[model samples]
Target: MTNVLSFEWKKEDYVTISGMIDESSDFSELFKKNHEVLFLDLKNIHRINSSGVRKWVLALDKLKDVEIHYINCSFSVVDQLSMVPEFLNKKCFVESFDARYVCENCNTSQTVTLVVGFDIQAGEKNYTDGPERLCPNCKQKMEFDHNPDSYLFFLSNLSNKKKTAI
Candidate 1:
């Protein structure tokens, strides 16, 4: 069975989405005529299927005029963002997201939160360096679990779009 997606409004401009995004997911309520800015928190999203991706892209297209700030994106959300070009638009900006890190010594894995323009710069083709993450179990530093290039592919795609528009 697919997990039900839920939406909660923390503020007039901020909203949180949790659970799974599938064919049944409905984002109609988020489509507003006068909503100028929106902060979308996707930290708790665990899974997304192809149908969900279609729905998400359509929803984003509707909000093309609104400035969207995506925050607390989970690994699943990040994966989709990297793979799907239509997952994000010119008006959409990623404020923060999580990256998987693993400790070589203890083999303990953890998700590190990275802020855009601070921890990592968007629109850069290469992202070799990231903020140092210390392992909880061991004192040694942890290494990023995924390849920076593939994980940050969306940033490069966004950058290309900006360049072509200029």
Candidate 2:
């Protein structure tokens, strides 16, 4: 199957990426051809493979001047962000992203949108002591799906204050 990357022009200097990224993603051509794009929004991306990861890292390594802004990131994307520190180096920041929780009593799942610098602790990889949600099915307090230290590991490398919507 052909892996396709879709771009939506939000502005002359910004573009939103929606779709899966794989070995076929040629960001060099896209970035080289469109030098005006300084911001990339990865809110709608669904999945990315190892090859995609390698290609993305390589592309970003070349484009150090470009800033990446992650918004509405899916769980898979969050996993990648948390796992690979270079996936979101100092030039990158997350505006909003998805987080998951589970209720042990009912086995129900919940997904929450976490805003950077608000829901997430400043200078840390964990959420703030904000509101807690009850499981819809069992009315029990939900637990975070992943460990904060491990799941939000990407924050250690990210500098969120740069040109972000935060």
Poorest 10 consecutive residues by lDDT, candidate 2: 122-131
**Each candidate's clash count:** 0, 0
* Clashing residue pairs for model 1: none
Error of 2 at 43 (Å): 3.1
Q: Highest lDDT: which candidate?
A: 1
lDDT of 2 by residue, 69-165 (tens): 6677777788898777778755666777777888999888888888777776435546434336688888999888777777777665665474544
TM-score of each: 0.88, 0.76
lDDT of 2: 0.71
Candidate 2, residue 139: how far the Cα is off, in Å: 6.2
- Write the residue-wise lDDT of candidate 1 on 1-166 in tens digits: 2388888899888899988998999998798546888889999999999999999999999899988888999988999999998999888888889998999899899988897766876777677755688999887999988887788777666542221110
Those runs of model 2 whose alpha carbons end farther than 4 Å from true positions after fitting are 1-3, 28-37, 105-107, 125-131, 134-140, 159-163
Stretches > 4 Å off in candidate 1: 159-166
On a 0 to 1 TM-score scale, where does candidate 2 land against the true structure?
A: 0.76
